[model samples]
Target chain A: MNDPVAFVSAMKAIGAGLAMVSAIGAGIGVGIAALGGVQAMGRNPDAAPLIQTNMILGMAFAEAVAIYALAVALIIIFAA
Target chain B: MSEVETKKRRFGFKRWIVLALIALGVYTAFLGPTIFRPISPVVVLPPEGTGLEIFGFPITNTILGTLIADLVVILLGLSAYRFHKSGQIVPSGVYNFFEVIVQFLWNTVEGAAGNKWGKRIFPVVATIFLLIFVANLSKLIPGYESFGQIKELHHGVGYAPVKLFTIGSLNVYTIDKGQPVEAGHADEEHAASDDKSAAYSVAAYAEGGDELCHSCEVVPFLRGAATDLNFPLALAISTVFLVQVFGVWALGPAYFEKFFQIRALVRGGILGSVNFVVGLLELILEFAKVLSFSFRLFGNIFAGTLLLSILGALTAVLIPVGLYFFEIFFGIIQAYVFFLLATMFISIALVSHHAEEHH
Candidate 1:
């Protein structure tokens, strides 16, 4: 049988791996948000010009948070 | 009763036929998860040259896709329209939809570049938007991307070809665990095939690799065009550069003041730190803006393409059928947003040194 402490640590590593998978959620969220803005711009031609710049800005902020989460997960995986 | 029946009969057949065809196209191709058969990429390995040869690196498919998108747009504008018009109805429903697309683009550029300059950039922005949008949507087409033969190394394995044209045969190659690589193989092949053939090392197969890999088996053939950073990054640079070009055109030598407004703050004194910091922030923001623009489009489109592909492959029929329409809508919107934001950045960059507006 594997040592309890080592098994516990390995399980922690596995948990970290699963946490990194959260990037997938972030990915889906980001894509949906972007599509929502894109759809809005398509419907209203006049508003699109002004809204698009803001849309990109909003997209980047969302993506940045996701990326930061990814970075943390990566650190945990490597450090562990 | 007679008049009503006649009117319904006149239009019924044509509308149903068109809808049926659209439905058929979706069911067969966009049946995502159910489609076990592989699709081919719209742009494939170059039979000739690639951009991967600078110091010998793998040139990504995204760059190749961008090049193809640019060419396709040129050909499209020069030759055929996506939707036909004329005596039928003059700007059919599709045409009106696209006219709206153009208007959306115009509003974007005009809003960013202002009414005066927006009109000037409308054509360029629209072309870029439409071309990229179409290229993205093209990924949904079935049989568009497929695997091909194991390609030989060029001056070695470092450089990869860009455009890939699916050939009659897709030969699978595998590298057996132990095999020898022959030097001067091109010469060796010349002798074996009467000196007219290109040499391919069976070494990879010798170690154990499948023969016909779809543009590097790890990545799917039907990839979204914007997934790789190269296209968006190159576009960001071009857009930002154009902003400077217009700045010089409009403000002459004084354009330098936009970046270095050191003179404006001499009278303000101690708040000079704030001015200096803001100036640095602007400088940093320029690059950050480029990074954001590239990553935003690349990440969003790529993730969508990847999910649709994965989901479509799993379910095959119904689920993917619905997503195709959304993808079409998405393609147009993303392109417009990208172009609009670019126009906005450029216009902001070109503002006069003496402008009254203070942020």
Candidate 2:
């Protein structure tokens, strides 16, 4: 409590941890995307390749949110 | 019956080999004096200086890694070219390997974009994938992020360096997992007096005995190229730049309309104003694309390298092997993701907004 330096470091650590909570949204988004893709593929197996490709694209977009969170977390830890 | 017997025999032999390997791995994990007690990897965000200068510019380890990846790509290209130039009807070896990858990528691109546009985009997207794939996978090579020059540690916490061996005049050193030398009273005094602004002490080195060499840490000669933000940022910038170029080349002056929909705002009333706002958002999203692309690749590979190092430091044997295989799969998937995204972006840019409205 006395050391301002330690207190700032602790705050940065906590901030970084909080930043990563955004990844939960990304995880759920990706899972839902996959679920839809799988069902579509099952319903129409012939369109599976196209569906798979689009599915991956959707997943990547979903995952980008988490990547942003990771970037923020990293910046908080290392640069801030 | 004979064919079935042969299949069973082969399966039995493979299973025994796998079992023996597992047993050997377990034994090494448990019994062997841990040869690779990697000093809780110093997670230096910025690439470490190699102390080598080219015309006074300091060379960083990530630059070295980038060069290595470039060299590998060049070699692969040359080898594949040589094999092709041989005019062999059926390709073998390296050319065959590249052929499968190229064919698969080409098909995907063609499927997404028409054949004409796919041809134009394929080379750029494929090259990015190959380069990123090489860079990501190169980190798994034995010496990377491990072997390096020993330097005096400037921080509070650092591992003690053990002299591995000597060759002629140079002494090889590696960090031992023994007691880490803490920041001494001198460092604390330095921190308290001179460097109150910074959280950590800016002291030159920690105090330690000659035998332990606790003040030393290794600055690795090569790190994963993508681990550095600059590499991915450079790639993302160029990719985005190329997307704009492709857009302009395909749509001429109409490409700018995608970003600025002034005509829509002037004529279409409420809906036109909405279109203008949407266009502005699209323009903003282009910039966001760069951030997402670079960060996605960098975060994945950097996290992967960190995971492997931490896991290796923790459990030096069987566990890391599984993780290494996982990393390999993850690396390829990341490379594919990057390629797929670039292809999609370029393909999207090729289409006019008006064309999409009609469809």
Candidate 3:
């Protein structure tokens, strides 16, 4: 516990773990987006391609949040 | 009915093959010799130096990957150009394959951004998709991040190398389950530096200790290009810069109006002030776009590589096969996502603020 290097490394590990917690929000956002897209496709199956395209685009945007969190976690573990 | 029966028979045959393979995997995993267990790779964040230099510039493995990816893109382009020059009315073989991809991409671009702007943006978007897709998929090739120059590990812990064989002067080696070198043993070997036979002996490996070895490790010749931040960041910067260029080209000088709403502020009303603030936020969001674009691609590809390596180390056979397919799927998805975002941003930029307000 007295070793500063060990203490700092432990803190970084904890911080990296905490950063990934932000992925929960992105998970929910992506799920909701998928739900809406699937429902829209069910309602109008003829527009499936358009709906699918938009659905992927929305999921990418939502996933970007989790990607950001991952970046933060990696920076904490490696860069910092 | 005959066709259906044939299809069912083929399916059953494939199922048997799969089951036999899985059974073999189970046997190898549980009942195989200790040597069959793969050495867990030492994971490093930054790309390792291959000890090669170009005019004093040290070459990293990721750079090698980037060059390979570039070569693939160039060769494909050349092939496509040759196919076009041949003037085949009905394309076939490799040309047909290229045609399908190009046609699909063209339709997607044209659908997202109407015919006019889509034509202008298609080249850049398609190039991004092709380059990224190739770069990401290249990681799955055998021997990537595997075969490399063996360098003595000076600082960090490394696995004991098992000598595979010797050809002429070269002694080829692969790692075994990591056995740490004891401090006393290491020092004794260092003292007897002149005796080459005293170094890296089988007896040392046989007498394993709790202590870790700062021994030799392999620095792979090639790593996934997107796993490196430099490649992704460079691509993101160029993509964002092109987005701005497209905006300026479309809207003329008025494109600047999106970022700085001085006219709105000059109106001196509460709503006008809100509009001006929103424009400032838009400017910040443009910069944020660069970060998001780079990190999204980098994080996904890097995480995929890490997952693959860890899974491969844990179970050397059947499990990683599924993950390889998953990585391939993700490679395509990430490439398409990047392309789609770039196209969408360009299309958004093409529209005038006044037109949006009217809508």
What is the TM-score of each predicted model, taking all chains together? 0.58, 0.87, 0.87
By TM-score, who's the top model here?
A: 2
Off by over 4 Å in 2: B1-36, B183-213
Candidate 1 vs candidate 2: the TM-score winner is 2
Residue-level lDDT tens digits of model 1 in B1-359: 99999899878978898678767656655552223232322222222233255577654545456666767666555433644423344554545656666777776677667788777666656776876687676655653333333344322211122323333343333222122233246435435774332224344244334332212322333344676556666776776677677778778878766566677577567686576567777767767666666655665566567667676645555676688777777776677667766666667666775674453
For residues A1-80, what per-residue lDDT tens digits would candidate 3 score against the true structure? Answer: 98999899999999999999989999999999999999999999999979988898888788888888888888898898
lDDT of each: 0.58, 0.84, 0.82
Tens digits of lDDT, candidate 2, B1-359: 99999999999999999888877766655555443444567787888888789999989999999999999888888878898688778888877887888898899899988899999988899999999999999988988988787665766676656667766545566765564666464345444675563433222122221222345577888999999999888889989999999999999999989989998888888999999999999999999889999999999998888899888777765788899999899889989999999999999999998878768
Instruction: Give model 1's TM-score versus the native structure.
Output: 0.58
Interface RMSD of each: 3.9, 0.7, 1.2
Query: Each model's DockQ?
Result: 0.18, 0.82, 0.78
Pairs that collide in candidate 3 are none
Docking class of 3: medium
TM-score of chain B of each: 0.61, 0.84, 0.83
Off by over 4 Å in 1: A1-80, B1-64, B79-103, B147-223, B357-359
lDDT of 3 by residue, B285-305 (tens): 888788889999998898898
